[model samples]
Target: MIVETFNKEKRNSKTVELVCDLGITGGGTAGVCAAITAARKGTKVVLIQDRPVLGGNASSEVRLWILGATSHMGNNNRWSREGGVIDEILVENLYRNPEGNAVIFDTVLLEKVLNEENITLLLNTSVYDVTKSGDTKIESLKAFNPQNSTEYIVKAPLFCDASGDGIVAFKAGASFRMGAEPKEEFGELFAPDKSYGELLGHSMYFYSKNTDKPVKFKAPEFALKDIKQIPRYKAIGKDDKGCRFWWFEYGGRHDTIHDTEHIKYELWKVIYGVWDYIKNSGEFDDVDNMTLEWVGTIPGKRESRRFEGLYMMTQQDVINQQQFDDVIAHGGWAIDLHPADGVYSKLSACTQWHSKGVYQIPYRSFVSKDIDNLFLAGRIISATHVAFGSTRVMATTGLCAQAVGMAAALCTEKGMNPADILKNRSIETLQNELNIVGQSIPNIPINSKSNLISEAAMEVSSELEISEIPFDGDWFRLNISAAQLLPFKANQNYNFQLLVKADEATELEIQLRTSEKSKNYTPELILEKQTFSLNEGEQHINVEFLKGTPNNQYAFVSFLSNDKVSLKTSDKRYSGILSVFNGVNKAVSNNGKQVPPTDIGVDEFEFWTPHRRPDGKNIAMKIYPAIQSFGSDNIGNGYVRPWGEVNAWVADLNDKNPSLKVEWDEVKKVSEIKLFLDPDYDHPMESTLMGHPEEVVPFCMRNYKIKDLDGNMLHSVEGNYQTINVFKPEKPLNLKGFIVEAEHPSEDVPAAIFEILCQ
Candidate 1:
């Protein structure tokens, strides 16, 4: 429904309906990502930020360093590195001010929008009123700017509340909730047994440059009668790094956005008094002139309005790691709460869930329980007090907004409300989109009753591929275009190599090309070693892995290539989650390092392209790990290598037996090694299975054949069961390790499982 005249062409002879693909109110973490995502999808999007600049807490005032469940201890998650808006910021930081100490966060977002022709950004604007008809449709959203004293109405099929206060949801008559709930509601371990108004307090981040100098601070205007009783206010001697400042919570009584002026005033006094005490105390001995680092003029709020959605995620959902039928996001950060009327404290002990591995955030939480038309983003998504605490992190919030943007786009395309997309779009599809864009949805367990159309990284991107395709910008889709290489004939060796700029030890995407024809039957590349991670802007990781090949293939034949291969979980708790479900990259980076991240190990994998295909054309497929390296290895506890195809291939070695001769197909994978003593005991077929060890593990032999149900003998050498090019394929696939049935089904010594990327 969009009619466009190029900048030079004004051929609008006819009227065109400007269908807003997405209407995002509130330019915070969620709103920014949402708008950017929709714009990238070729949708006309309108972004409204009340502030002059974008970023709510992280920018407007620049809080710096985003927090996320993706590798906080030191590991970095490439998946969490969103494309669109978030990517723009990272790339800008990389070249403009790699140190990040002196970078303008708002400029980065502004640049991205200015460059994108589809997005219309409205700054210093607010959604004053919203109207909806029937149950699940938003008719118009009226935006007013006091600066210009103007008002404009926008009509969109979808609307998102990224205000962090659930502003749009509030005006749209959506169901919403505030404060904490009693323990009986969900019976979570950290519940209060009774409801209370306590929510996480807000903060203003400050950096310290004079760690060695003496700093001082005094009390504020607030009464301190029972200050000691306040849970988290204890100022341990070393509590105030560099200089100290206070930014407790407010807004419990009224609107947060409209009354931010009070917050700033309160912070200024709190800071001045705290500094007064320090300047006047003996604590000044170690310092010369106590310098005040920065104070948060813009507050970083922790709690706000939470809308009621189809599913209100509770602590139970987090505790049991419940699999949702419509998962759209994942969060692992602990639920962090602070007192509303207490001294220097956060209520982590009460509202927080023990950090197990990350869990999925449901799609049902995005829409409202009452006003079907309204969608929410950021900290305002549907959740019990405890649930919101876990997902309130900005990284996860960015994902929430990304999902909102995508869902809004879906609504416009199908002429439905976003709430319905929560149901209509299969959980698999939602999970796939998040994963393709690098958002975790690890809860699509096959064992659960939810949709089995399980989604992994739909089309894997990043270093997993053969070539790291460079873009003019930071945003790059985890996709490849092999058709562009069309007119390419079959049976040709179009090999490609992967090389990292080593500009910085950054987790990046590498893309190759492939078609959908050769997925289930291909051998993926494997890194021969592991990596030691470091964090100093950049490091050097030098290593390489050879490409793999499929078992058999004929020229001019069509095949399916795959985008991702699923990762298994490991056993061991880096966090509270089961060790098995952790990511592979984390294990690699943390493993086998003497000093760890200093003079570390390097794990490199480079897959090569095979020469031919069934149809006469060159074949190459993109490669990406099913899970981000931060995924579970599934091996659990420690490594338990699985039994591979028996080293032995079966054939009727009658030529050596003087009896009969037959060819055996090796395509059907084998898990155990079994040698028929050859009733006659003649030279046991030449292809005797050889493996890691004869007694400790199972190995394949060259001379063995499987009997099909039809009693027909299937040989390994004849290429019968199935053929795959272990080399490069055009289209990538979602692959797990081999699932083989051992000849001897023992209970304790189950078949050994090799890593998926390995043979």
Candidate 2:
């Protein structure tokens, strides 16, 4: 049903009531994701948003671009996209709004919620009151819409406060803390020595569009009079939009929740002032044709009331990259902190520190310690200000919301509180459920039970192989030795292929090493060593090694420094792989050199590094084995490219009929097939400082044909830019096995199948 009032307040007064399994306050990315997840899991859900549009911040009203783990493809951390629901949103947005249009993204988010049959979406409804059955639980949420003069009473078994500011939790008497915590409180070095009780602040962003003819902009009377007053004046440009004006922030020292109106006015003045300088201050004459397209009315918020939870994440936890046993979501963004002084600060508007790798967001972080039934997602989750800087990203929060929704689904099923699910060690079950639905957890692979490759005999025609190490037509000096972590089973035998470019014939030493489990997240103890002589120019070197099945899961292929030998480098960071620099754990560059922690974070960078180049370097190598040999693992085992490599079974275009064949011991009746193909997550879906938005995801399998072994064509599917493809038969096809073949495959990229899920 579409309900809108043209006037701001004059409309019919209506009262509406809804009852559901889960009631979610706020329609930010986190709330939308939670609603979508729980609804799809067969739980009745009600998603309430104050704005007429669904997306918070990301909606047209706020105009903040959605960013998460990728951190704008920051260094080393490629393929760090917050998978699951956010991935769906990003992928769909790429297809629908490749230009990154704010208005279009609004419809996309709206459609996502409205399409969910199990989700009752109430837009333009603000939660003004909460009805509590007891001190520990909320019975219902009472919301009112002034525009339509409608009152809403939402009753539910479980409630989620994804409200960014935690209004529901606050009203419910949930124990919460606002602003910066003292370093002693959490033993966090990054925290202030004394509690400021100050937040990161709210920001307003402006977008500009180009006109063919010259256009002029007149300064609004409220615009700041002097451009020199801005701190990062040089950083502002005509193309700035959304997060580009991150420095246009204020109201941190003030009560952000209560003082939002004042903050909004201040943000407006700063935004208009910046544009005025660009258009009229004689500094940017090139922008004569550009005019204001949009300016956010609602400031995108960073920190607010953080509800106390079983675990309060701190800077120490983020800095150490702590892996929690009860991890539900993970964050890779740097611990970014904007000074409470904001635009007025003489120092940089933001300061960032990187972690070695991604850190875990525990399930305990979302479950309220005081309110038994209240779950928190988004900025309102339990975290000190320093830690909140990292977890506050929409993508990370959305994943946490996914966890909450999944946990809520289980709660609805088992008739238990959110805390009971974790305290009972049912978190494993929850994790398994999350993994089954394609949510990525750090250090966790797909559940073995759901892995079809484990049960069936699997065969791949060929692994994607290239003769020369694919390079960007550039070479690096052999100053530091490098290695990449490759997954290895105890019993499997493997060899590596290198396309070494030597200036002269030289002997290069190679070693295979394993790590001390997942602790260091780097290569340790050399297992085997060998030396190979390479000729000038590009030469192939294959170092073969066989070992008895071992206990460790990862082995590194390390190369010793050989003078005049230049190794190939790739920007891509493959999953299950870590690189070494000069024998030290150098995969991540924590040189204390600051990079603008773009929306993704300083934890990720634009360039990967083989050596500590403060400028930036590629992290992974193209020098991998030609063909990998393993036992009895199906294509699904490799389907999830958790890191960077295309997790797929490839078939050469030279082959007569390129296909991946899977067979079982007996005739297995299958009705559905789920295929997760490569959508090239490495490509940017939206515009960034580095590049424009990618209109389409290249390298995806297209026009593929799935058939039975009897030469009968079961179905033909066109890969229409979808990452996950589900094919269901009108009736269950009684078949023993099937083959997916591409008659005319993608030319440059070989036909690859990540996984084929059959049930």
Candidate 3:
């Protein structure tokens, strides 16, 4: 069906020319996200992946667990799951592949891409050549597929180098820097004093399976003579996998790209050596039955060449929690940097610094300065070494892909380049488009067009007047006070009540305050304070907001600790809320002496922690405003998951037929309807040490009915268990009102609907 010509050197000479709107190289996390996003937006996309499978490092070969804003549930960073496409993938995985199976996850990624009819996916195709029409424009790209021995030429208006190493940019003559930059170069506080070509290296991981009989591991000829060479080798267990061994690194002192083969060779030695030590060295004789099940042939890479862009993100931008006007994405991961020498270094494997909260990643970072139509996503995007340490993560980079993919679609529609979009002040349009697709941009509210419920009057059956939901999870401790952000008006005095349980008669202190600095969530100014003496058992206690409360926004109401008492919290955590906990770090430079005994668990506790406890146990507290459950404002707020407060349309548990009826002021034509249901965010859908949790969350609505006025059933959706559900009528529905009823809502708990959308 296809023909090819060979040159004098026997290389393929003929080219299969294909034209598309966007040509994306690489099939890694960022690349796949970019291709899928662009294709879904009606752009013709060409996704060229050099590997046989998608998901790059997350594929079965590498097997790295995807992590982003949540930062692996680290200290103080909670309720930060990445939104948009990543969230969709996670929710889907939770429903379909709860076992954390890599092969299944790969199929999910592949199906998402293939389902988009506008995408032309080419697997095992490597783009090795580029043609530049002028000094700044990319004319076309040349690629080869060894499996089929085919040579192809792809021409597109826009090209994205999602390739982890920036190969496309390198071939197109775009400026890029490899390895670490000097501290003085970008004024980066975490940069090395002297610039070096060394980079964070390549690593390989293997999986072990237990057998009924003892299995022997013979040392390969090239295996390391002594496993003690790695100081942290004692932590290795038979149950551990490659992901748990984040420090199994090598080849930072050498070229990570050009010498990949050499690096892979050395990694093999260590991987086998570690196994031999466990089985043969008498160090882990308990692993006598454990044998190697799977070994990674392709080493997962961390850092490589970083391309230059209009703006080079620096450490200051991250530490300051800068909010750029053109921000299209955000990152909450810590600035985790590994030594150039990696595992071979005498010092620890990594050094990390956390931000107060999620920080903005501007759109300027993805646009190339030298190339007119060239865009860079993934690890190659422009950023200082320290900043890259955080942005290089898969989830953050996937957000960048969504930004770039949306930008590329806009450029095609507007007949402009990346620079022109900025010049025309169309960045807001791009951001709005992103937000419409459920991407959360910090400080940017939802576009007014998609918020249809703003005008409708909402009704609920009843409210949780006195009873409180318990927020008990492993992440929450009895000693810490968890604060929920409740909405309050400026300069208004009000009464706030808390439903709490106590093991014995105890004293509790509550404080009303605001964030000391604009960037953090920790409470600072004490607007009102009160102490309560309570008896055992669950009871309601009232605290009053006297005066001087800031204008309408979230108020941080903190419930201080009584060791015998525990505040009832929702099992699920929400955003715009925070908790105070005891910290493990007691270093002097951390200003441990100055922090309030309760708030030191967070990165910026010192600025507000004035009260100290002699026992050194940080004061634990839960902060929130008065409960406004079942209020009319619940459905209008642009929050789906309960953050500081439970913002949702709820019906009383005792109601036999609870429903939320919304009547617009005038009859309107609706083409689409969407409902966001609560999936119990507290029960995370993640791959853990014990594998995946329950695939289906109990809180998700299983059966619901949609109807119009006069009790006319328009549609009935049953056995529904997704976080988000969409319905489109064959023709526009001319109606003045509609009612949503949860036929079989979760028992005992009130039926809840997060948001109702109509357009």
In terms of TM-score, the best-performing candidate is: 3
Minimum summed lDDT over a 10-residue window in model 3 is located at: 610-619
Q: Rank the candidates by TM-score, best first.
A: 3, 2, 1
* TM-score list, all predictions: 0.54, 0.82, 0.86
Q: What is the lDDT of residue 336 in candidate 3?
A: 74
CA error at residue 501 for candidate 3, angstroms:
8.3
Model 2 regions lying over 4 Å from their true place: 1-12, 193-197, 212-214, 423-425, 451-453, 465-639, 643-648, 669-671, 687-693, 730-734, 742-745
Between candidates 2 and 3, the one scoring higher on lDDT is 3
Per-residue error (Å), model 2, residue 118: 1.2
Candidate lDDT scores, in order, read 0.44, 0.71, 0.72
Highest lDDT model number: 3
Output the worst ten-in-a-row residue range by lDDT, candidate 2.
606-615
Task: Return whichever of 2 and 3 wins on TM-score.
Answer: 3
Q: Give the local distance difference test score of model 1.
A: 0.44
Candidate 3 lDDT (Cα, whole model)? 0.72
How many steric clashes does model 3 contain?
Answer: 22
